[model samples]
Structures are given as C-alpha cells and as structure tokens.
Target chain A: MLSKISFLSLMGPLRSVDIYQSLWLIIEGMVGILIVMLLIYLVVIWVNKIMNKIEMSIDKNR
Target chain B: MGSFSFITQALGEITLPMVIMWVIGILLIWLALAKDFEPALLLPMGFGAILVNIPHTGVLGDNGILQWLYHAGIEASEALPLLLFVGIGAMIDFGPLLSNPKMLFFGGAAQFGIFVTVLISVLLGFELKDALSIGVIGAADGPTAILVSQKLASNYKGAITVAAYSYMALVPIIQPFAIKLVTTEQERKIRMKYNPQGVSKTIKIIFPIAVTLIAGMIAPDSVGLVGMLMFGNLIRECGKLDSLSETAQGPLANIITIFLGITISFQMQARQFLSWGTVIAIFLGLFAFIFDTIGGVVVAKLMNIFLPEDKKINPMIGGAGISAFPMSARVIQKMALKEDCQNHIIMHAVGANVAGQIGSVVAGGIILSIAHGFGL
Candidate 1:
C-alpha cells in the first residue's frame, strides 16, 4: 500500500511493498501493549477488591 | 614466538581503528566519571573497550575470560540480564503503580517509539530483525534491550546496548526536550492533585504474579522476561524474604551488573562497533526515545479532550511512561514543580514511571511475539 505513495520512496532492499508486514507489527504491537496493560489494571482492581474485603472482615472480627 | 619477532607482530597488529576505539572507550570512561553518566555500566564498558581492542588480546581468542563471560552470561541463555531483571524487579516499589492503576495505559502508550523506530529502520534499509533490535533501544530499559537484541541475534548488539544505556542516562536531557516539542506552557502548567491511596499488602503481593500471568498468557515469548521481573518483585513484596530480597536487590544485582557491562562489551570489538550501522543505530535509538515521548503525551492529551477539566492529567505525566523509572518520574515532577511550586505530581508520575517499566518489558515481548509470528 505504501508503494502507491509516489512521494514515499524507500532506500532499502525492503521496499514500500514489503512494509505492509512491518506496518502490521507496529499496529498490533501498540494495541497489544494497551490490551495487556489494561488487563494488568483489571487484575489489580480485582485483587484489591478481594483483599480489601478480607481485610475488612478481619478487622470486624478483631 | 621469539621475543624480537613477537614485538614486531604486536606492533603490526596495532591499527588506527584500534586507537579510535580506545578514544571512544576513554570518552565513555570520562562520561561515567566526570559527567556521572551511568557510572556503574559505562565505566567498565569503557575499560573493556580498551582491553578488547589490544591486538592479539587473550580476551577475544580461546581461553579469553571476556569471551567466556560473554558466552556464558549472555549468549548461552541471557542469564545475566534476566537475573538482573530479578534485581530490578526487587528494587521496585509497585505501591505507586498499584494505587494508580490507570497509569498502566500510559505505559502502553509510551512504547510508541519502539514501533515507530522499527518502521523507520525498515524504511532506512535495515533487515527486519536488525530494525527490531534497533527499535527496542527505545525500551528505556537496558536489560530489556540486551536480552531482546541478543535473542534476536542482532548484528548490532553492542551498538544497541551502548545506545540504550547512554540514552537512558540522558533521560533528564532527552525527555524534557521531547515533552516540550508536543506540549505548550499552558499544558505544562496543568495541575493534577496528589491523593495517596492505601494499597493493601495483599494487593502488592499479588500484583507481580498477576502481571506475569496476564502478560505471559498473551505473549508467551514474554514469560521469561516478564516472569523474572515479577519474580524479583514478589521477593520484595512477599514480606518473608527480606534478606533474600535485599540480596537480590543489592549484592546479586551488583555483581551481575558488574559482569553485564564488561561482558556486553565483548561485542564492542573495534571491528564490530565501528561500522556505519552502529552510527545509524545510535541515531535511531534517539528517535525511538523521542517518538516514545510523543506517543505517551499525545495519548494523554487525547484523553484530556474527553475528560472533565478537574480531572485532566498533566500531560507531562505521560512522558514519564518510559521505563527509565524513577528518573523519568522524577523528571516529570521536577518539570511540574518548575511550572508551579505547589504542583506536586510525583505520585502520579511514579505510577506512570513504574508502569513504563512493565510497559517496556511488555513492548520487548511484543517485538519477540511479532518476530515469532513471522516464524523468525
């Protein structure tokens, strides 16, 4: 797709025609980070909820 | 083997490039001692450069201590860097990040530079593997750079390590400039209040493990990298292994660091590191950092557009999303304070900084995942 941009000439052996794969890597890599980080966030929230509840029960017993 | 002939052979082996490498080595040493630029790593790497470049040095040939260290520590299985990750994980306090869990998004956003640099490197004619290695210099974490490049077998490993560590040292200098490029004075002055949240001990204990499982499941290639890091953190938070955690955080980490720098320099033989590719790798490394800052800042700004005014994040916090850790977080705080003395954003920035730590490793894993996807 990049090859059609007449103004975007590449200097390497991997021409614009070869860049579609690279573009995909870039796209998925960023999205993947966002997804993974978000998942981690959810885990923290989930873990906190459970732990906080247990701690509250222990305090009531005390 | 005669004494007279040995002198002649040794003299003949001396070349201008070797001298040039010595100068470069000296420059690194000077930076370490005089400028305090990553003294722990640069000092030894600089000394190693001088040692390896000596003609017919036993360090490069059979029975070479340096060569043995390189093969055993790095090339054999990435043991040293991974071990170092445990120490790094132990040294981290995830309290800030766990409290401000939302900062994790900034971590993902800050890795924008790595991907951008990969495309740019490919555009400039680097083979995809070399381009990926070069781009990872933006990870802003040294061990991640080394492990990624080594695993990928990038020909530019030495240059990538040098670039990664050097740029990390220059974070204070590089980040402010990059943050300035995308933000105005008004935006820089954007104030965010700091509210300390009580992070439960159990949550702290579970965080690293949860991060590993979550990150590992998505990118199995990241298990080693992510798992080791989280393992180190577990020791720190487990509450029962204080001494073990201290050892991991102190002595073990120190000894490994001492080995890591000089061992990595094995690849910095004058013949390997003096190429045009090294120079290009260095420049591309800078761009990765710049682009990372842009990515994080832009995302934060975009988020501001959708949020209420009182809830707007000081976009500078996004720049701290690189894995440069406390340094990046500290820089953001310094910048915030400069804008307004009462503006204390250290907690928020620390949250993002630590998240960057995870973000960078995950980004490295993503690169590995992409590499695997291509069947490389």
Candidate 2:
C-alpha cells in the first residue's frame, strides 16, 4: 500500500483524500473479492466431498 | 383573466434544459420500446423523466407521488433495490456454479473494470463517492449500482442507473467488441467440455446461506443486500417453500421492478440530470463495463498458461462474468457458436454468469464497507 502511495505520489491520489481513498478502496476491493470468492469455492468443494461421503455411507448401510 | 395569467406563468417556467430533458426522456423511451433496451425499466424511467422534468412538475414538488415513492422506496431505507434483489436471488439457480466452482475466479476477475473506472473517475476530477458510484456500473447489475449510489449519496445517481441498465442491454454488442480487443480468434474458439455433476438439493440450499455468511462477515456492510438475495435463493432451494419461491420470483419481483424503474426518475429532474458529471458518468460506465469484460478475459488467458491443453477454458466465458446473468451467458454461447458450430460452453458460461451475480453484490458491499471505514 505504501509502495502504491509513493509510486503514485508524482501523478496520483496524494493531492486529495478522494483519490487516495479510492486507490486504497480499489486495491482492497479487488483482493477482497478474490479472497471471498476463493473461500466460497473451497466451501463448495468441501461440501461436495463431505456430502459425497455421507451419501456413500448411507448407501453402504442400505 | 387570472386563468390566462396562470397559463402564461406556467409557459414561462419552461427552461431550455426542461425541454431537453423531455427529449432525452423520449429518447430513453425509444430505446426501450423501439430498440428493446431493458424495456421493463427504461420505458417507465423514460416517461417518468418527462414527468419529473416538466416545468413546475408536480412530481418534484412537495408531497408529489413520485417524490413519495422515491423517499419511501429509495431514500428512506433502499427498500426497492433490496426487495428487487430478493426476486433476483430467487430467479437465479446456483447449480451450474456449484458444480463448477472455479468459475468464481472469473467472477472476481471480471470486477477489474469497477476499480479501474474508479481510478479513472477520480483521475478525471470526480469525487471519490461519485466515482465509486460510477465505477459500480461495471457490476452490470442495476440493483447493486442503484444501492451503491444511494448509499454513497452520489450526485450522478440518475446517470449511473442509466448507464448500468443501458450497458446491460448492450452486453451483446459491448461484450463481443470488448472481447475482441483482448482475445484472439483462437481463444474465442476454445471449446470447454461441460459435464456438470449432479448438484444435490442440500448443497444448493447451503450455497446461498454460506455465501451470505462469507460476504456479510467480510464486508459487514453487504449484510442487507447479500442477506436478502440469499434469503430469496434459500426459498427456491429449500423445496418446501415452492409457493414462496414462485411468489418471490414472479409477482413480487415484477411489482417491485415496475416501481423501481419509475421511482428512479425522481433523480432525473432537468436541473440535476443535465450536467457535465452525467456525461462523464456515461463514458466512465462504459469504461468500467469494457474493463470488466477484458479483465475476466485476461485472467482466463493467464489461467490458460498454467492449464493443460485439454483443460483450457473458452476465454469468452470470462467476459460473461459480469452480473448480466443469462444475457451475458447467452451472448457468450452465441458468440462461441459463431466461432465454431460444435462448441457448447453455455453451462460453463452460465456458471460464470451466476458467479458474476454474487461477485457484483459482494463488490458493492465491499465499496460500502470501505467508504464507511474511511468516513467517506
């Protein structure tokens, strides 16, 4: 984040809180979406596996 | 003599912008009717634009009906968009996405346009909040755009709504055009095998609940939007609430949509609508949309570098990862067919398209959370 600030110091968000805040928001938004989506993906995969196991055991009992 | 004077006074109240707004209103109506550009919303919005823009328009006056709807439906608690989201959530089927969870990556990737647009808007001298509103146009979901703009108290709410819905209708032309700029003919022709595993009813029911929890905890601000959307989806997947799901997806949704369209016109008053900010918002909205398309495509292309030949994805599906839903999914499917007759990637595209829906909602929540965090 500091790197982004200094790098953009010459041409970007340093002039106002709007730009600076937007800069941070953009970085966080992108990464935040990735993290959330990835977690959901993992959850889906885990659920599928767990569900499959439960069904398999049910079939074995039958 | 008094009646004649009253007529003259009314005529004298007409400004050039008011007449211009009437014409703009007509144009929106034409686009909705003649061109079939989101007729469900645009037709009412267009007519209401004229209704609100008329000189001494009653709708803009104290206690006007439109004003009441706007205040109650939108301003007070954002009930309209959130209610519409319940309908939207019920309408969506997450089976395709759950069977192929990796499509969630495309959903996340496709949001690139939003952040890019904000950076551009701020660079071009717009306020952060306004820029945030305009950037959400990339979300490609009108409800999320409206909700975010309302939350941020953006000045360009009307323009953002217009761009969000308009570009959503233009997905066929815009997605293809943007897809072409970054992808090759070969990439567009990449055929993905779609063998969807059976998605159990249990997983289907859990999916929305889990999404609500994940998104709400992280963004906290997204709780209302995600919660309502997931609630609708839960109604659909629960199997016991068939009647409730139908209501949410049908009459309830249709009714809210009608009011939501017309009520949005409250912001279209000529004095407010006619501005440099609106024009810039239109352009920025397009930029956000295009970048979103390109962003998804680029990520797919990057992913291709790591995957084996047989596992390569149709990069066009990446473009479908905006929240346009079945429209985005359908457009990519048609484009894929145009490139090769035998390639059928609709299922994959559908997965990504639905992922895009959740993606856009989460993105909106993320924006609100960040804004509140910064005291913006």
Pairs that collide in candidate 2 are none
- Name the docking class for model 1: medium
Off by over 4 Å in 1: A1-11, B1-3
Tens digits of lDDT, candidate 1, B49-127: 9999999998887699999999999999999999999999999998988888889999889999999999899888888
Candidate DockQ values, in order, are 0.65, 0.45
TM-score of each: 0.96, 0.95
In the order shown, the candidates' Cα RMSDs to the true structure are: 2.0, 2.8
The parts of candidate 2 lying over 4 Å away from their true place are A1-20, B1-3
Instruction: Output the worst ten-in-a-row residue range by lDDT, candidate 2 chain B.
Output: B1-10
Report lDDT (CA) for all predictions.
Answer: 0.91, 0.91
